[model samples]
Target: PLLKIANDMVVDLPTPSNISAWWNFGSLLGLCLVAQILTGLFLAMHYTSDISTAFSSVLIFLHETGSNNPIGLNSNTDKISFHSYFSYKHLVGFAVLLTALTALALFSPNLLGDPDNFTPANPLVTPAHIKP
Candidate 1:
């Protein structure tokens, strides 16, 4: 019954005569949100929630980064583009998301970290720059 109701809602849904990049981008964002939530759930299983350990845990995770990208699936109907074109279209969306993240990390890393983290470090020497 619930499945029938769900299908009925989307049954014969009309596609707009003219679609915009922004609408495609909006769907991309929705997909990204679902990916983020699922990945967060998995990470949360091991992540330290306590304030005391959260900072250290983040640093550990950062240091351990290599294969951190969450799985993503992109699908488009014949209306959007051909397979290769659809791939590049989604690539543009991914680029936009990556650029936003890079900007945040560069401009406001402190929003997620303490003043000590914002400080530059010389990895060659002792870790005196780190706050106690």
Candidate 2:
């Protein structure tokens, strides 16, 4: 019953033709939200009470990296067509984001990191460029 309702609401609903690439952002943002949640979950699982170990674990996760939408209204009311259009846009956005991320991680891993972050941890003294 619920599935039927959802299908009626989303999968078969009609959206306007004016819905542009901008509409794609809702779905893409949703994708980002899910990605962030999963990342937080995994990081929390990997985290530890020990500061040094946690720092190191986070650094490792950073270096290695990790492998890891919306609504409308009526015109002609071709929901599937609009859904397909939005789906394609969503996928293109993901692909572009993924490609850029992969290129940066693979080509310039250190580009975004602070120089001090890669340095060896020293319990005796805090680095001058501490992130906090």
Candidate 3:
């Protein structure tokens, strides 16, 4: 039924000549969604979504580089700074994901829909529901 509606909608629309790369934005958005899902799954294997262990699990994965210190440096300081690097990388990935989503929406507004979701990340609190 949904496929029929989509086909009818496409038939009702006029096709554009010289379609831009923007036409491919849906695939890009799908790729981003897949990446997010896979990463979330991996994280979930070790993540305790409860309020107590969430932050600690993330810290363990991000901060555990190795035990070897080259110049007798303190492990704690190195881990702290390295964890910041991991955090920055995660933030950048999210930014790219958002950019891809925005581009898709701008080029193809009909493809977008909203579903109720938990609020964005909060280390101190647990979401009341988990979708999957």
Candidate 4:
């Protein structure tokens, strides 16, 4: 079945006899992009961006195949769709991400944010909110 599909898609596809070098350019770029994506997937599956371990993870190939971090390969593949831009799976995955972002913003706005951003414009004069 797979061979038949491949044959129909590639082997038996229509092509002009006078196809120029530009025609091959597109195919070459497609193959290069596919190779790059596969390599990126392999890398994402192996390493993690944990705050504490990120520095050390550089030295050792930290295997994250077992971990369920959202930045992992599974989550990346979940959003891919060749047929349509807004597929059901893609929308659901986006909704999940949006809900998590909203929850974090409502409950703990600065939980994962930089502490410096919450500071007063000028530390010498106490913040206006603290005066009242």
Best by TM-score: 2
Give the Cα RMSD of candidate 2. Answer: 29.4
lDDT of 4 by residue, 1-132 (tens): 533333334434456777533453358753554455566656766665454477767545555344545566566556655557558779899999999999999999879989898866875787667756
Q: lDDT by residue for model 1 over 31-76, one digit each (tens)?
A: 4644655566567766645654888888888667633334322332
C-alpha local distance difference test of each model: 0.61, 0.63, 0.60, 0.61
lDDT of 3 by residue, 1-132 (tens): 533444344445454665332352256643454465566656866564664477777777657853456555665655435777889999999999999989998997766555444346688766678564
Q: What is the lDDT of residue 88 in candidate 2?
A: 95
My TM-score estimates for the predictions, one after another, are: 0.24, 0.30, 0.25, 0.25
> Candidate 4: minimum summed lDDT over ten consecutive residues — where?
2-11
> Residue 30 deviation, candidate 2, in Å?
49
User: What is candidate 2's CA lDDT for residue 45?
Assistant: 61
Report residue 20 deviation for candidate 2 (angstroms). 71
Stretch of 10 with least lDDT, candidate 1: 71-80
In lDDT terms, which candidate is top?
2
Please identify model 2 stretches exceeding 4 Å from their true place.
Answer: 1-80, 118-132
